[model samples]
Target: MAEIIEDFLVKKDQGYYCAYGDFYIDPLYPVQQAVVSHAHGDHASPGHQAIYCTEATAAFMQIRYAKQALSSYQVKDFEQKFHLNGVDILFYPAGHILGSAQILMIYQGVRYLYTGDYKLQEDNTCEPIKIVEADVLITETTFADPNVKHPDPKEEILKLAVASNIMLGCYSLGKAQRITALLNQYLPEKEILVHHSMLAFHRIYDKFNEVPMKYELYNRKSMKGDEKNKVYLIPPLTFNSYRRAKNVLRVFASGWARLQASNDLSLYLSDHVDWEDILTFVKQVKPRAIWTLHGDGRQLHAHLSDDLIIRDIFTQTYRPDFC
Candidate 1:
């Protein structure tokens, strides 16, 4: 068990506590004590006994997991240290979403930082990412491959606007908000058209007082015969299946858009950091060991110097007990 703690586990006592970004989950540890990094579906699990997250995260969680009983979670503010199991833990903004956070834990003299899903680029919808030093850093390598580099957001948005009259397809949640905000800043008078899913998320953003624009939401029914020059925000699944109206152009916004399959005319606007940004962050933090998760970690590992030990952990299929 002790060896496992050194090799795979963070700490071993009652059960297992693994830190990823702002959330901590331990199968052996009480489920009631999990810490959520944000309200994103991939990061925040529904029906947990109790959760700790930022206030904005809590509000979004309420809207998302409304069926679950209220008061089952606790909201933790930024930079506040909370102690658990003799370890000091703190949450810092990750700049991926409105309430996203990176979890930093200090046990005895060792410090470990878990970056859930983060973006170093400036986004108008959320706070900017911050740099913190730690002994060990767990980060995401979503866009870590050497070939993946993104254009500046402002430049990309301008190109996207000039390339097509109709902007189609984007994640309705954080990504959509970001793209919309960019459009609002650049094309203030243009009316933006959004699908139902995007509308729902926009409503949530409005509820939280983070909406940067005054725009109208439109469904498929409402959009019929509406030929106004506007940006249409739709989920990827919907965009791929639905036939676009004649003269409508489609562009996919994601970190993976750099691939040959994803190069469309609109733009590849990503919410995640590019390869250069990842390396820059690693150098800034200078962690003793780097743990990479969630997408192409091996590619990232190969680029870094040998001095920084890179460990790729596959959380999707990872089970700590077997180790």
Candidate 2:
């Protein structure tokens, strides 16, 4: 019989360590060689000696990190299998954002996959989720609770029409670009204004030809009382601190609305797999074993036991003999 990947894996302070490939997956801090899952701040950071990821993710990294801070990068196209330390690694589209990926690792005859902040729902801005069947499936359980389910994003986007001039609170990166594209697609007649900080990423998105939309760098002169179908997109962190007029309605876009309360209307527009979608993905992949990442996955562990063996990666140590 051929050799197989072990039933156990290692957990270090940096991230999940892959012994067969001699690499780390989405290291929390700087490392010698890291396999990045995406360009999102929590999953990706600068100062790796060498980085391996999809081409689109590499482009996003260039936009986020200055060249001087990033040491080296190896760009891989989606579905391209590459060899590192005699181990096979593959990248599959993860649909969380523009360049997100679900990493698949194969050692000998056994396989494992890591879903890095993924969503199965449709988005107008980026690639859709690509499913990969593996012996072990590790997922980001951001919204794993049974009660949490995201409404259609276009329905949420349509809510902007209620206020003549609306102010949207979104993160400058993924959430901001997603909403911007949604607004353009669903409500093209509305005028879209964006914060200066988000303008740079818009150019990056434009360069990639992803989410092409018209937007103006925010200016007070653009403020008009006529306010029929006008929208302002700003970083939530910045918008909360600014001194703005009371006339415009404020709205927040996030999945955490189910758990937390926010001022004004909360639009459940998330890029992560919700509870229902998470279950659907598990059934689609049909993995022999499952592990949770991203958020506290107690609910998922409790609920998904009937489908597959739920393993806890954080508490596991490396083992070689058993597969």
Candidate 3:
């Protein structure tokens, strides 16, 4: 069991540990020291003794856990090399959501890149992704299957422009703001009725200029045909409860459309690298070894030669991406 762990990171009872840095990476439970990758619920939780992450990620956490506060935190600017203990650390743009980052840790002359929930595609709602070179690459293979392909967001958002009204189901934090910004860019003429759950995140993104677009709050009960030609950005959880009107098209924005058929019209939008982009990223990063996290990596194994070392953490505990 000990031999199965990555050299740079040990799989501990609490989380992925780095003895050199004396900290955990995305710990499942709060710990004394943490090197957080982002503010998504699963990755960033309250009560950590201390955290090192991007400035935006810290701010988002304050909002996410409004009533609570972490013991302490240090903000790491993108691409700025910093030292924690004897280890060198750097954070890079991930393009998945506001303040999403890929962390690079260098110790003992070896470099390891941990991509904490990333997408290579362009997103106006957050900083664009930047490729990093390292000896070992830890990737999120959420859509690693050969068949998974995400349609261009602009093309999918354009479909809403032609519709009289849209009940768009998406993750409240990342997906909602992403689609909102896309609409602001391509369908600026149309009004967006955003759910209350997603409004705070939109404001947070706007506060950082991560999302410069504008939208209105949604009041589903009071909505009439008066709010025509609008897109109501609601939480994916509420997709079933959303009542459809004659002109309103009920749609779910997700990568699930690529893998399976859905009862509602699927937008096929995702804040994750598709199969082609995954292959492209691997080639560009050019790591000696690859560690897969958050999703299956069978697609990578099938294409990459047998000489490379590839470990999929999902083989232990597969879970959904916390958007």
Candidate 4:
């Protein structure tokens, strides 16, 4: 058998390290060279000596971290191949956010694909996912359980039809932009308002969007009058900070059940792939072995056949002959 994934890349205290490439993928803390998958805080950190990612990911990182974003960087387009210490690498769309990408690294003639965070659902706010085959498939099993089936986003967004005024709590980066676009497409009659923190992300998304999202900044005046049919989009921090308001329904847009517990209405919108999507993606990739990360993989492990090895990076130690 070909060399197991451990020889090519393995998880470390800092992040996933590729010894051949001499870089870290989505490191926990800043490192000398970081191959970022996206601009999400957990995936990308500042103060790196050098960085690599797509153009949009870099833009979002700059907007989020400002001057401290990085000391040096290189941006690449989707499917564009480059080399890192002789390790051939390229990016493919992950479809999770504006610049989210699946990093593909080839070393010793074996292909390894690292899915930072990905989704298969149609998201007008960001680029769509592109599938590529690899010998080893490393994936984030965020919603890998068979029972977790995310509802259609269109139907979930339409749940707001009955409410004249809605206060929607969502993440500032990707979620806000997605919900804003959905509201425009599905609930055009309602006036959409956005929180200040998400403006920068929205501006960055607008550059790549064919149809610019329609929204107004959240202001006290916008909430003052009995503004019927108004939807105020606010980040989770602001949403949690707010007090109960009269006649306004509180809703949160997320796939996590915990986040929806306190909401008056539930909107099961998410940017990660569900179990079915994961299986579909796997079939497309046809990897010789599979390694899971980011979430529980027991369900995925039990579901796959013996021909394909499923290793959970967090739960089990890696060995050359493990596969």
Candidate 4 or 2, higher TM-score: 4
Weakest 10 consecutive residues of candidate 4 by summed lDDT: 314-323
Ranking by lDDT: 4, 2, 3, 1
Candidate 1 lDDT over 180-294, as tens digits, reads 8888888775568787767767766666654546667776544455555567777878877765455566677765644226435647788788889998989888787887766
Cα lDDT, all candidates? 0.70, 0.79, 0.78, 0.87
Q: Point out the higher-scoring one by TM-score: 3 or 4.
A: 4
Clashing residue pair totals per candidate (backbone < 3 A) = 1, 0, 0, 0
> What lDDT score goes with residue 65 in model 2?
85
User: Candidate 4 on 1-323: residue-level lDDT in tens?
Assistant: 46764657778777887777788899877688889999999999888888899999999889877876454878899989999899999999999999999999988788999999999999999999999999999999999988899999999999999746888899999999999899899989989888899888888889988999998888888977865889998988788887677678899888899988877989999899999999999999999889899988888988895668888764325433222
lDDT of 2 by residue, 11-107 (tens): 6677777766778889777777789999888888888888999877887788788762444889889989998887789999999988789999888
Q: Model 3 — TM-score against the truth?
A: 0.89
Mark the 10 consecutive residues where model 1 has the least summed lDDT: 1-10
- Candidate 4 ranges with C-alpha deviation above 4 Å: 69-71, 314-323
Candidate ordering by TM-score (highest first): 4, 2, 3, 1
Model 3: how far residue 272 lies from native, Å: 0.7
Clashing pairs for model 4 are none
Best by lDDT: 4
The sequence of per-residue lDDT tens digits that candidate 3 reaches over residues 73-184 is: 7888999898878989999998888898998988877788888888988887789999988888888888888888788888877877664677777888888888888888
RMSD of each: 4.5, 3.5, 4.6, 3.4
Q: Estimate each model's TM-score.
A: 0.84, 0.91, 0.89, 0.94
